[model samples]
Target chain A: MKISFPYMGTSHIVVSYLFEKLGFEVIYPPTPSKRTLSLGVQYAPEFACLPFKIVLGTYLEVVEKGAEILITSGGCGPCRAGYYGELHKRILHDLGYPVEMIVIEPPLVEPLDFLRKLHKIVKPKGIFNLLHYGRIALEKLKALDVVESTLHELRPLALDKQQINQAYIEGLELIRQADSVKEVIEAKKAALEMLESVPADHTFKPLRIGLIGEIYVVLEPAANHDIERLLGERGAYVHRSIFLANWTRDNVLAHGEKDIRAMAIPYLNQMVGGHGQNSVGEVVRYAEEGFDGVIQLAPFTCIPEIVAKSIMPAVSRDKNIPVMTLFLDEQTGQAGIETRIEAFLDLLWQKRKKQEAS
Target chain B: MQAYLGVDVGSVSTNLVVIDDDGNVLVDLYLRTQGQPIQAVQEGMKQVEEAIKGKKIEICGVGTTGSARTLSGVIVGADTVKNEITAHAVAASHLVPDVQTVLEIGGQDSKIIILRDGIVVDFAMNTVCAAGTGSFLDHQAARLNIPIEDFGGLALQSEASVRIAGRCSVFAESDMIHKQQMGHPTPDIIAGLCDALVRNYLNNVGKGKEILAPVVFQGGVAANVGIRAAFEKALGLKIIVPDYFKVMGAIGAALLAKATVKEKGETNFRGFVVSDLEYQASSFECQGCPNLCEIVNISVDDKVLARWGGRCGKWDTLSKTG
Candidate 1:
């Protein structure tokens, strides 16, 4: 069977491996490009969120390459993400593209919904066989997360762009070749070693930039146009707020630990929920920790980030930091981003120099 | 007595609110933003100064928020500049101590904020789509030759609800036309439009997540009783409309400034005479690269107040105070 998936940062890498292990041809959407966004905007409803536009673009591209089955995450909240699958399916069907969509809803509230969706896509031989593949997928996902986390730290420290990218390519290759959970762990270790061995020139004072914004845009290199690589190559250490570990920690585990009494605190005190809370906490933390500057990234029209943008000035003043808000749309060009980054870095450098002189 | 100044410069409106030390609002002014934020702030500040002229209101601190917060902050010498979310959340919390959800629909944007235990847990905003936003409703009201203020009352008088496709402004207009051609009453069609708007909001902007009670609907749209009624019927819960609904963002910003000023032991608010300063904005496409980002520079009496919009932070960085 031929299976397809949208580009969802590092998650796609693991999902592809799982499908490949099950003897299916897995077609991952090409890395996001201007063309991808244009295609998405062309096919998608003009008013739909940017993420939806990107996803639609990915599916259209993959379907053209002969992928029959599509898989995507499902949501159950005010976030339009939950309904994207249904909407996308309707849109595609209306456009004369017939295919099956398998949505994996969150396991917390809708385990049976996920199982039903999963069963429709992959009819495992039996319970044991299904459990076996699930175990493999879980292990691969964990390994991928570990490697990605380590790389997030290492990418900022690499001497040049080539070295960091080489390490990522090797790491992904190692992950793809691993056959067992033990092998996955070994691959992660090997990837870490490769990254650690890159020569480092610790001469220039690295500009520390805290990246805060939407999860998908922050983690996805394709979405942000390899912003970390561009910044890292220019002697800056990128402190990204979104990561698999952080997402799991904040969203999954922190739910029960929240002080329910805080519900009484009115607006600012209340959780005006979504990624805004996490972003506020992260930006505040980054400022407190003395990051040279902060970059707020968000898809154009993203509400939570808009809130974050409003609050960042207070964050900037409290911590004496500078924050630049970048709204990413399909029209975000590389040269535009590079110029902005260079100027931001220069500002940070000047600010640091001023501090040192004083 | 010490007072703080708060300015919120949004795409649609610019608001100025003055609050005393105990968080009591003393002076407030709301003006259309009208394409120029610096001018709006200057004008708004003039009104505020006039309103508090006789009182012993010393401008102890200034805070700015909304889309143009940074520029407004620089122009006014604001001690604190925050986003609309933080300012709104803070102000809303102060007003309604137990606000769990905040549904803010303004002229150009709509936001759904989920609050848990007083911290913003999850929030969604709508900037791309116009269906659920106030501007969309304003357009519809204009097309129907009805004053926007009376739109809600007319909708309430709707006996039969007609379903208008509220997917986008284009679709909504066509659907409304179709409903009108079907001989539907104006009130019923208006109510249906409101219902369609609420449905679109719930389906698109207010998608997945928990929407608890004690929901406060603010911003300019909160004044629309029909939309509020639609929300109540759709969600089956009572929605609270704060007293200063239209200017909540500005109020929240003032409250934040108060807190910041108290902590810092001083205020950096420029005097109200700043309203007369000549302000201008000019843009230039940077020849630095192919990106061709049109950098916007704001100046007052030839002194650069702020520079922004170039993608690479070139201009913004120059405006930064180290």
Candidate 2:
């Protein structure tokens, strides 16, 4: 089968490797762009969140490339994301694409059924064989996370940000081409060395800005207008709360929920659905870490993020940290976003100056 | 006299201010942008030249602000380019000295900036909504056949109060027409509109923001006394309107330029001759990648001065650093 998946940052690197190893021809969708967004908007419902539209556009592009199977994840929450798989299937069927969709629901919800579906899809020698490959794939994911986090840290400090960005892209490609666990580690080491080769100013301490919000918008550069790079270029150390590896560790392996839930209890007592509690908890954590500011990015009309945004003011006031929420949509312009970012950096710089003086 | 120049090319108005070394305004000019920022800026420059005619003033530094800051910065060879929010806050604090809040309603946007001890603490701008902005009021004034200049005075003449929805501009217009058909006087309706706009501003942009005392109201909309009265009534605090309310952004830019020149000991100003220079602005779609970005180019005598509006930074970086 020619298999495909929607792009979410570099998650595709591991996913394509896994599928290709499973004896399927992987057909990668083109990078999401203005054409993809416009196509998705033309076919999608008026109020669908940005990620949904973009994912739909990705699937459409893959279908044009003769992709036969589409893989997507599913969730059970109050947020509309839970119904994405079903809605995508219906929309695709209505549009006459007729591609097969496999939704991997959370195993904690229905382990037996999930294993049974996995068995049929894997069709391998045994479950142990699948586990071995899965472990290798996860190692690659970890390596990618490290490379990206390192890039975020070094980008602002480097004399040539373009050189840092180039190294990061080359690093991603190197990891994607590696086959074994040892190769992944070697690629990671090589990538870090590449970043280290860039000339940097180590004496300067840049403003610390934490990113907290919806996972798709936070991870996808195309959706958020390359906000991580924009902040880094503006001389701020960018720290994001969500990455594919950490997301998998929390949502799949089911580890590290206790700490976040405990932090969120003071403000958001319960989960309001997709990543709402995570956002609140991340803000509190960033505040405790003494970061200069937090920026919450969410798609327009996203319910979970909207709920999180409503409760952010109290947290910001109580923590004595400034928080800004930017609701992005197709109508968002680069000029407007850049202006807001410039103003926000000025605010942070002023706060830092006041702190130093007192 | 050594002076600094600040240009704010906004959506509706292009304002320019020339300030002396001591921050005293030497000359100011405001011209309607009218969907042509280049011509508006050139016209404003010409008028400023005429306004300061025979004065021994040399522009020591230049700055630009507002939505079209980048374009204007390139045209005027600005030493500093800043966003409108910072520019407004700087100007407000400079003028009022103790301004704790700034309520700025401009052509297509509204913002509330909170400051404490001469530093910005918090701020919020209206998102994806043009309901309570100056352009909406301008449109309504034209529809009602009342000149925009007399809008505030006519509203102040109302003897009775009415309510109109201000959640969306389209809904607000239909509601106004309904009230007009229901026999409510024009003054009453206008007063109701002023209240509605104020209400929208407070509920939307001012949400979750602490509006302290010593609030300064400025922007093009500050001239609307009806909106000012509505703000005073809503917040239950007296609002201070600065003498250079409409040109506050420009003043702030000039102040920043003055500061920059003092630190750098020189300026990048291209002089007043740039006002008469012929420049051509054009755009083309880039086919370099899947994102068919519409790249814009501004040229003088077919030599590209700047290019922007691309998703990839190839053109943008080339324009800025190359």
CA lDDT of every candidate: 0.75, 0.89
Write candidate 1's Cα lDDT for B234-269 as tens digits. Answer: 999999998889899989989988888889998887
Q: Pick the candidate with the highest TM-score.
A: 2
- Compared with the real two-chain complex, what DockQ does model 2 have? 0.70
DockQ of every candidate structure: 0.03, 0.70
Q: Which portions of model 1 miss their true places by more than 4 Å?
A: A1-222, A225-358, B317-322
Worst 10-residue stretch by lDDT in candidate 2 chain A? A249-258
Compared with the true structure, what per-residue lDDT tens digits does model 2 show for residues B1-322? 9999999999999999999988888898888999999998888888888888888888899999999999999999999999999999999999899999999999998999999999998888877678999999999999988899999999999988689999999999999999999999999999999999999999888978889999999999999999999999999999999999999999999999999989999999887788899989999988998777889898898788888887546786654533
Interface RMSD of each: 11.6, 1.2
lDDT of 1 by residue, A68-107 (tens): 8888765424556668899998888887788788877555
Question: Can you tell me which runs of candidate 2 are displaced by over 4 Å?
Answer: A124-129, A253-256, B316-322
